[model samples]
Target: MSEDTTQDSAGFATRARIDTSRPHSARFWNYFIGGKDNYEVDRELGDRIKEIFPGLVDVAVTSRHFLGRAVRHLAGEQGIRQFLDIGTGLPTADNTHEVAQRVAPDARIVYVDNDPIVLTHANALLTSTPEGRTAYLDADLHDPEAVLRAAAGTLDLSRPVGLMILNTLGHVADHQQAQGLVRTLMAGLAPGSHLVICDGTATSEGMIAASEAYNASGAVPYYVRSVEEITGLFDGLELVEPGVVRVPEWRPEEADDAGSGAPVDAYCGVGRKA
Candidate 1:
């Protein structure tokens, strides 16, 4: 299905214009994950960055795994029935709704993203269980208040909501602002609400170099913050077991040790708002 071409109050298309002339974060990431939604320009930049950091593919793939595991834990163990997935990237396998609904068929989800391409591909994101509901909103991350208000139409703000902000905060250049955005969103949710965050870290030189190259691509820049800074986002919340560890290291279900000694370039954690 294609994106809805509906116009917003601003008279501009709610979905982002498909500017194949430049690389977009969603499409670039899509390219990294081996999805066919990206363009030639995105593929070119993705290849260039891969040359700088071959492990990026690992980071991207591992981060996605982290998302799946977090959603499963929330749905299966925590009994979470609602999700607010901001900066929802290109629709890939095992999305938040897919994972959550699989465990709890009545899980409701609201996905927010400003990317027009993603908006166009929103049909892929609209899938939901017969007992649940799913909706997409074209909005920016900087405006968390608007995001919450829009999401409230589909999610119950007075109940526990799992806010997922995976691989998206880096777009906000100001660390403090990013934290503030998160805090503002969490403040709107009721107690027992959960926050699941995962983003790339500046743990390796190669990853840092790749980030730099991507920043130079004229697209929005993404910052790879330190682990301490990433952990700081959950200051007032209760972290789950093995708090704020590498993405692949976050509660590995199997003992094969795919992440035991390996240093992943991303950090993730699940926290509950008290």
Candidate 2:
């Protein structure tokens, strides 16, 4: 279970220096979501963390559901056709392109991730409706400028774009830097663009224990911030209804048997850049 060295046939190339020895957060998340893009190290860490906080699995799955709902809302209700999804994890069910294209077949999306495993799974992400287009960009979250530049090749930056950053900000240990990154990325988009964010929070002892155990692992550390810190990410934007609540509580579809009020150890929201 080494790092994936496979090239993306979709024309995205990762910069050299991707270390396979250490588990990556994207791959670990892929493992949790029942995807085969992760290495043994990721699975081992994921399992260890799950043992400490079993609810993490629910958080991962529900965060994905939140992504679907948010994308659908933007594409369906808001009629947003372009999406710039930074920190795009491994390809999984109901990805941004899938949900957006389902709602509006002509939607275009650019997915940004630097993980080699995610690069290997980039083909699955390349799928798009005949009327729509999807592209993958191998870039780091820390380099939001490069991400926006590469994304501009696929998306029209002047138009409204849905910026999806699901469960990826925790990698930035510095809270101010993380907020700055979000603000920088949002600043590049047009007035009507939206920011969709969700991340694991330091809400409970079990979650804290899990974060500690994960940081102790060889993988890069991910810090769980307080709920207020999470909310601060959306400063200056108009929040959608039921703002910044638990992932499962966000405007869930009725068919989703998962109750809207159920508590999950993660928080999420969608904000419009007014």
Candidate 3:
């Protein structure tokens, strides 16, 4: 085909893959977290969900804050220098690489996601410190071996890596399946590697209602689980102090606002591989 034809075909394929007709989880979460990379559909769903559970906004905001604190702890206190962040959503402020490289300039991070939109915005996530490296893999989380193989090109799997799943695993509807996926990913890493996870929990009626509404909107379903299920993701690993708890309560910083300490629907924890 001609160059112009090839370009047009590629553009068409990209547009086809991004279904703006319905809200997507990444874009909807981006809208919830005050980002500009979402469409009207995402905003509409986000606004509707807010009406169902105003606290859902807190879950989004506080979960983001939890990411910063978690990366800082891993890169600073734990002496980790590499990261494999799967299901990393749209690039926003204080992303995994930004937070990790800030604590340890030489930290290497590989971000994994299969969303075409996320891939388009991957350049924003590719910047790294001179001492560190950053790469984006167009890979899915269900296939642990493929993700690890691609990440190995950027990260050293033989060394301890900070595996971050964040709000992404909720896409897997089955609790056992999600737990098994986490175990498989962890099994591929070294002994000292740490698993950092946080997700929305079905701790309240409003949150549950919000989850049902969002899932009904034709977006990929995100199943919020009980705190017990959330903790179960770290079964083989040693739980960091404070164990699994509300995102903000895990390790609050002095700079956080008073509301940051309040309970939200999201829960998070860091666990070290033995």
Candidate 4:
């Protein structure tokens, strides 16, 4: 646990080197959520986006809360014990594994991300309780088979799993590609598996402007899609209670102030595979 390593008590360390000059999506999000794991360039881009759309920070916070609530519902009410969290950003509060394991001690989680920074913090993402297990996969969503194959090492595919795609689909700009990717991933899971999706929507002019600014920032361009397109991703699945609503409206916990408020430009839904 020195400057040379990010090793947890289990002697795991991040192998991906950090590049501070270029802005990264994971670090920028971590910054918005009030974490210190961001660089100056990331803050600069965030500040610029905030100036364009002040509500974006609200979207980030509320979207994260939606992930927590969705996971809680899947683990507690649905009795799901496995989770596949793709595009797992830097370890923050209420991560998929932490929240799932809190409800069911033996819950198993597999986190996949293509970002080097995210992989660099793999140690933090891999920390798990004795009763449960967690693992980080250095993989991409474009290849769903590879991801599922790698996830098998930690999770049981035969059982129901809560597949979480929170705020990550935007990174794939192509609409058809994104939908196909989701379909492929869901197809691999057994029947009764659940799908959780939360992504920024193109519902407001301010959000559109902010997205343009972010896309031009030299980082990966994230496309904010329409509500119909977002909901289309769950075509084959049965949506849960408050289906495909704003992130803040997705079954907020009593303590979740941001989630209980008015709608942001982000929408989310929890759907069960029939």
- Overall lDDT per candidate, in order of appearance: 0.89, 0.87, 0.92, 0.89
The list of candidate 2 runs beyond 4 A from truth reads 1-20, 257-262
**How many residue pairs clash in each candidate at the backbone level?**
3, 0, 0, 0
- In model 3, which regions exceed 4 Å deviation? 1-12, 258-262
Clashing pairs in 1: 3-120, 15-116, 16-116
Off by over 4 Å in 1: 1-16, 255-261
Candidates in order, TM-scores: namely 0.93, 0.90, 0.95, 0.93
Question: Per-residue CA lDDT of candidate 1, range 147-199, in tens?
Answer: 99999999999999999999999998889999999999999999999999999
Candidate 3 local lDDT, 47-97, one digit each (tens): 999899988889998888889999999999999999999998999999999
| Candidate 2 TM-score versus the reference | 0.90
* Tens-digit per-residue lDDT, 1-274, candidate 2: 3334343333244424556677788888888878887778888888888788888888888888888889888998999999988888878788899889989999999999887667767889999999999999889889888888899998999999999998889999999999999999999999999999999999999999999898888788889999999999999999999999988889988655453344688999999998
Per-residue lDDT over 9-119 for candidate 4, one digit per residue giving the tens place of the 0 to 100 score = 223434335667778789989999999889999999999998998889999999888888888899999999999999899999889999998999899999999877887
Model number with the top lDDT: 3
lDDT of 2: 0.87
